[model samples]
Target: MFKNLNQKNNDSIRVEKDSIGKKEIAADSYYGINTIRAQENFNISRQNIHPELVKAISMIKKAAALSNFELGLLDEIKKNAILEACDEMIDSNLAEKLELDAFQGGAGTSTNMMVNEVIANRALEIMGMQKGDYDIIHPNDDVNKGQSTNDVYPTALRIAVLKLLGPLTKSIAKLQEVLQVKEEEFSSIIKLGRTQLQDAVPITLGQEFSAYAEAVNRDRWRLYKITDRLKKINLGGTAIGTGLNTSHSYIFKIAKHLRNFTSLSLSHSENMIDITQNMDIFVEVSGLLKAASVNLNKIASDLRLLASGPTGGIGEIKLPAVQAGSSIMPGKVNPVICEMINQLSIEIICSDQAITMAARDGQLELNAFSPIIAQKLLNMLEMMKKAIDKFNNKCVKDIEVNSDKCKQILDNSLAIITSLVPYIGYEQASDLAKEAVNQDKKLIDFIKEKDIISNSKLDKILKLENMTSPGNNLSE
Candidate 1:
């Protein structure tokens, strides 16, 4: 009836619509019968899992189903159907008749149903039965027998997130290498260092690059730490902590099965109380992601500021131009890639906040917002990974330091006061710096006016390397 109406002309379309009584529905809005009625019923945010995330989720689900089947938690028939359905979703091979919404509330209840419907329908067809024949392979009883929304959703999320972690780890490692290379490349170049937005003293460019590398290293370690937390699965703690209504060996068996399927060495967390009630692990992961975003944002901001202008701003370093800047400003290349990374980092930070709130919002025994937390945090990871790749490849890899500009800035900076300490004494050097900065006079001019040192002595002490390098503590 529906197919006939869809193929009919306007006259037939109107007649069918009138006959059905206001039954016209958009396909995009409703993905056929397989879609959750509430999703069509609620129609909230149009947001759906991204394609990469969907693929990742499908992979996780298949692995989990395979594990359960092996453990005897699910029968072979149901397990095979679930695995096939996961592949269909992952490969976008589902038949056109059973349309499904990728978006639904209840932390992927819609997605779970999509999988259930697809598997159940496919299994029915295999048995030479029609679609929606729940008697053949029931969606809830047979297919989702040993699972709950809580366990399935979080487990799938962890598995999906872990998959992305591989790429994320590679990203940080690549960035670390780039920063180390920059350190070597800019080793001898002296540049003015800033503290609290004021010039402090001269420092070799290598030191600055080394700091970025260290930050990346720290983030990578933080990622590893959070991954340990994510590895502890709560799959067996179905419903409200206890494995009620499940077989005696089902929980342990399924978890072990999942472990083998993923090869992630996953363990059932010993503390079911912590696992079921507290989302500290979620918050901890969010914090690590937040730290990563902040670290990357700092690096990106510095790159953009350092590469600000050839004539106006501090053109201390140059970032590769990935895009045009201003429409009217000729030769107006911009650090668009770095800017994008900054923007994406900010969003990740915001998402981290959302995860934090969700963690705090959960009541005893079950976090109602686990779904949102999982979605937002996973999105943060994905965005952060992509942003890092862009910044590393398009911006950091080809960056060039303006040796002349660095030298000029270092020469003019009053922060060179420390260099004069050994010869003129600390009191005199400090006073000289203050005078130079306050009077807008050069340090050499201030020194000359104050008779702090003769020109020959000043020249000997103020060589750029001598000024910046922290030599043996002669004062000490």
Candidate 2:
């Protein structure tokens, strides 16, 4: 039932009453009393619920309507109204009107209620009735039939996460492809490879880029595998896992309708109680995201160090100059894209920690912190996707290897002494390395000065190719 507010010059107000009390709602608003209460109670984060989540929830409602119609539980008129309302919500992006804070109490009941009230009012409009006419089409009885926030919230969260993973996977794969291209481009440029911040051996620039490509490829694969975990959803398990107040036929058939509606490979969880009680699946996906973050962080750090300076530091590679690096230094350029990715990675890592704690803090039947987990996880995914794209287009693809610098550094490195040990024995090679370091001379130059071996043998032993890989013995 709805009551028009009779206050003078307040024609734009309507009265909606729940168990708590009556509240004034906007006449044009699709949401109702529960949503208003949530908006007023939890103004913690001014940010509203994410649009993807709202869309996912709308899809669930549409699927439920279709399922109820097929089961002969709901009349065709109401089903058509609900379906049309859902279509309007999705097509016109009506979720922008949902103003409840993403972080809230009641285990996402407020979020569920916000969606329900919007759909209920929109359905009433489609039926040519005024909004908040629960007597004709109740939000709980008609729109949200056979569902609960416990089931619907987590299920919608899974759908939203799966939707986001598609773009994230593509971004990561694109980054991997770019790194592979760089590997081929830098294949022949040889450089010094360092361990523990000290030169250890000779390596081609291509080999370093290949390692980065391989790491990203692994992350892409893990992202693909994590979708399987999300596919199993706990829909139709109203309240708890007992499937209380829902028909067995509805319980078994809802997932089929949801899969068809969402075009996602969704399946009903075999054990609803387990799925509801444990949010480890979300934690598992978050862990994989963390793994991807770790890989990106390491690659970005390596690029920053490699592109440290043109006159000092490694200076073996140059990153694309996107902007002026400093306000004070006139000619400075920084690896801002790499820095951005590094900072984003750190944020993703911290988000994962939050999700982990939220998952662990589950009480008895439900996890009240799902709102925060969903918010943090979605934010991380979107941020990481953009960061990867920026890093790939602006940095990785534009990386320029300094071949001259590589050769110069390699010439000065005493790490080449490793190649001489196979032929000269360990004690002699150690003495030569010490002398080369003490005299501040190249290993090749020191060897030439001492006449340790014949010129031809020394030349054969000290080949750059010999130092980088394994093959024939240097003594041979």
Measured over all alpha carbons after superposition, the RMSD of each candidate to the real structure, in angstroms, is: 5.3, 2.8
Model 1 lDDT tens row, 188-252 = 88899988768877788888999999999999988876777788766756676576666656777
> Which 10 successive residues of model 2 have the least lDDT summed?
1-10
- Alpha carbon deviation, residue 36, candidate 2 (Å): 0.6
TM-score, one value per model: 0.84, 0.96
Q: 215-323, model 2: which lDDT tens digit per residue?
A: 9999999999889889998888888876888887897778888898789999888999877778898899899999999999999999999988878789999998999
lDDT of 2 at 408: 92
Worst 10 residues of 1 by lDDT: 11-20
